[model samples]
Target: MQSKTPISDPTLLQLPLDTRTLTIGGLAIKIYGLGAHSASTPLTCIHLLHPRQQTHEYMTGIARSLLHTYGTQALICASFDSRNHGARTTSPLANESWKGGNATHAEDMFSVYHGTVEDLRMVVEYLGVYLRRVVRHFVVGVSLGGHAAYLALALPRVEGVVSVIGCPDFVRLMAARAEGCGVDVRGVFGGAGLGPIVGRLDPAAVGMVGLREVWRGKRLLALSGGADGLVPYACSQPFLDEVKKAVWRGELELDLEDIVYEGVRHECTSEMVREIVRWFAACFEDMDGGSLKSSLAL
Candidate 1:
């Protein structure tokens, strides 16, 4: 089933800096304050392949940056753990028959992705309800979380997405994972027919093709580092190609852009955060050209 569902039994407690902690649909999430000038709605951040602890500061910082740039209360920010990653390191489904029934680790990753897509949708829907406002939503994700951002694009409310160091084509990512350093295939992957395993579970085949409809009026910013050893430039080609197609078709007006940090790799630097903050600002307004250039140049 698709992850799209109404929020259930959500409980939220407001804290300092306008942030809050809430649990809904069995997931725990953090919400940073709404932008000074924004509605109670939010831009959600999906963490990397890891859990929420590692990237919380950076993710919340993006929300804070948006608040500073837009100066509007419309841009609230949020984040949550991916399946079997951070706090929920022991996902119930991870041990279910469907998880490892197929013997390839790439497929295992797909299983995780499937669960994450659901988790994200649940949270987005829940937040919409909890805020009790006419909320507009945006998403940003890193690594596997970035891929989740792409999937979230299909949601009607998600108007913009920033996918950092992530790819839309799961097939390619699976191949890369299959070849990651020191992968002992004889045990987890069952050691045979690696190529065929990822083929059956291609995210494109699973559900990404509909991004055409989902992306009709959306904006996307894809960031990659040139020297990165993992998730090399090629892995992002499919997402770039999709963006190019949208721009050529006039389906996107603002933020149809991509950037590569020649010296950076696998990791998004503080400078990248500045750039993303700028990209989001462009999405909301035609701000002064002077500040605009500085955000992108960082």
Candidate 2:
């Protein structure tokens, strides 16, 4: 299944912002206005985050496909290029000479995780006023978006988190990338500068403690590609282990479902999109195929 499917080009309704800013520590941020098509009350806000290299438009296709199949509407969908990427990059040779070496790339990821999570929380807070037409609110994210979704779920308002091929163990992914390049995790994470920050932010180790504190009794729906080269199976295994451990301790009763598609690579496939749509449809009530304009209007 090597999941690389073409992104869908969708026509969406752009919404006017109501003037709100969420403060995350010292940083005050606003949610990018993607669009607002009113759906039935209790709308499902599908916030699709991009993979490491992809753009917001790449995930928009997946979001539109799911919305089309399930007859759903997204209140907001947004993504930003990570540090050392796009225009915000600080790398000196980002255009020609940069090979995306290790070192600070991991730190950039940490920043992305933090920034994305803050944005997700702000969106969730904004939507909480009117989107809660139902009892449960779901947030579905793919890959790096999945990581952001997990962080969003840590908030009390998020009812469920559906992550596909999300890298929960940041250190492990770095370590795997390092190992693939014949480097050492110990030397890398234990080195002078990278070590201390990694110790503080590594999701596999101490970083996830706050997440775990909020993870109790939360429903987690996850999927992974069996043949993902970038995100190895071993990496996903530890996350599953954490979930299972939480389940055993009565900290979380994980109604977790894992679907591993054979031959699927790091990208998402059309079949996988269909599966996600089917699952999302089940989460809604009285889903009837109707006109996009009317169905979205509450």
Candidate 3:
């Protein structure tokens, strides 16, 4: 894939936005940053995923910012509400945690985000057909969306990922939450017959060998808050450590960036957003230079 130069004129950044909403696979998808010139240029689609309990509209600002920064370069930002969220809300109780009186918090949360990965795959397939142009896909997910971003690595078109305050190890995160909430973790995710269910869905349970195959040649930028009480970095540390070790041992090839902002809470700060944009810019540069590997080729 030959990289095209980004439009340098600042005034050109204000090009008329080609925003639209489409219903695909029964999910409403909002797209931004495409214009009349999009078909002539190679396109990069970035999916903006919002936090838990929030709708796709919450990602509008980030989508607009990305469009403003790379709109002239044929960049398009897309977003959709996760399952049991926004217009997809079938049961509000399923979104709650154990403390909120949801007995199946672990399974419920995993199903929503895991289901998101499936939704993303379907969307990616349709976008390629709908756009009728060369397009590379990337993802930027916050909190609940971030968790889905990690799982999306299994997909073919997801070339890069930005996980903001997301956990790769669902079991670790749920276990900690259950312990804090005085819920029996084993009953929910571990021991008994529930272990297999989680092992089948959890990324960490896939083990390093499986991860090497899924993560090879991919790029991941994980932004976490050091002081986040809700989804602390500790929940993801063990999994990340193994990833680093795999790279060191030459068992995996990946571009991984893990940063924890001090004093930041569970929220996605402005600094994190800026970092995400910067990372995407760098990835584009690499892609143009033929340095970044595409999942499609893998």
Candidate 4:
């Protein structure tokens, strides 16, 4: 689903900036563009997630970019530290992979991201009440955050997801990593292979039949790096292929746009950010049945 057209540099729309923080159910959530003056208005909230070992501050620039583009439209951007990250850091070693000496790398990473999904669900459930306004939820995740974005698809409130360098097949990715790291695959995947815990949490383990129900009516824009050595695109291709098949067969009504940038690495490039902004604009247009050309105008 790579785009044939050339991707140009993004021209950000500069607007008034408003930043604030709230502690919701023990999670410190940072919000941008939604202030006391605008809390009563209905808005769409886009949650931005950072990469592994990074804090919510890592997403500040992108949050500002999104707010500048949609702030006037009652759109707010929010972000929070994932489990074992930022303010939630309990054991830094738990964040590392097998190569970094984490014996239970697979379970640790999966739990962190899966727990993030649950945290998001709780935030979404209570956010409206706090603001006293109707709120819609969308998510944009990068690297480790991207993996969480896939799991967030199951959330009833999340309508769209933008995954940058994320993998859907956690078991495959972990198996490959374990092999390369000289760690016993059995230790990671277990003696039975693809351990019960991973099978229960991994998105690819859900199978296409289950995915049909989870992905229906959702919008996904997956940006991958073709040469990504860390989270290789190959690990996710099989699942993406099945997703496309389901869509083509009318079994899943999903708005899926998966693109691989040739020669790119695991990093999120400026071009990827541009595509994300454009995709968000397009999704907003589709939802409202109105043009946002002016909002995106340079």
Question: How many backbone clashes does every candidate have?
Answer: 10, 9, 0, 0
Candidate 4 error regions (>4 Å): 1-16, 191-194, 290-298
Give the distance in Å from residue 192's predicted Cα in candidate 4 to where it truly belongs: 9.1
* Residue lDDT tens for model 4, 1-298: 1212112333442344588998899899998877734546777889987788888887766776666656457788899999999888999999988878888777788889888889998998888778887788889998899999998887877888999999999988887787798876766576765478667667799877777776777889999999999999999999999889889999888889999999998888778877888898877887687422222111
Model 2 C-alpha lDDT versus the unseen true structure: 0.55
Model 2: lDDT of residue 30 = 31
* Cα RMSD (angstroms) for every candidate in the order listed: 9.5, 7.3, 5.7, 5.8
What is the C-alpha lDDT profile of model 1 across 74-184, one tens digit per residue? Answer: 556677766666566664444332223433445455566657767766765666566555445677776666666667666665667787776777666555654654444
> How does each model score on TM-score?
0.70, 0.69, 0.90, 0.89
Off by over 4 Å in 1: 1-16, 34-58, 91-104, 180-209, 249-255, 286-298
lDDT of 3 by residue, 1-298 (tens): 0012112233544656567887887789998866645465667889987777888877766675667776446688899999999999999999887888999888888889988889999998888677676778899988998999988876877888999999999888988888898887766654664578657656788877777776778899999999998898999999999888888889988889999999988887767777887888888888879886654632
User: What order do candidates take by TM-score, descending?
Assistant: 3, 4, 1, 2
Q: How large an RMSD does model 2 have?
A: 7.3
lDDT of each: 0.56, 0.55, 0.80, 0.80
Give me the runs in candidate 2 sitting further than 4 Å from their true place.
Answer: 1-42, 72-99, 127-137, 191-203, 206-213, 285-298
Candidate 1 TM-score, C-alpha based: 0.70
Q: Give lDDT tens digits, candidate 2, residues 1-298.
A: 1334333322332322322333343333333322344435444555556555544545545655554454434434334443344444565343221135545555556667667666656555555443344323456667766666656566666655677777667777777776666655575466574666545444455434555655544556666778988776678787778767766777664456667888877766665666666666544433334311222223
Q: Is candidate 1 or candidate 2 better by lDDT?
A: 1
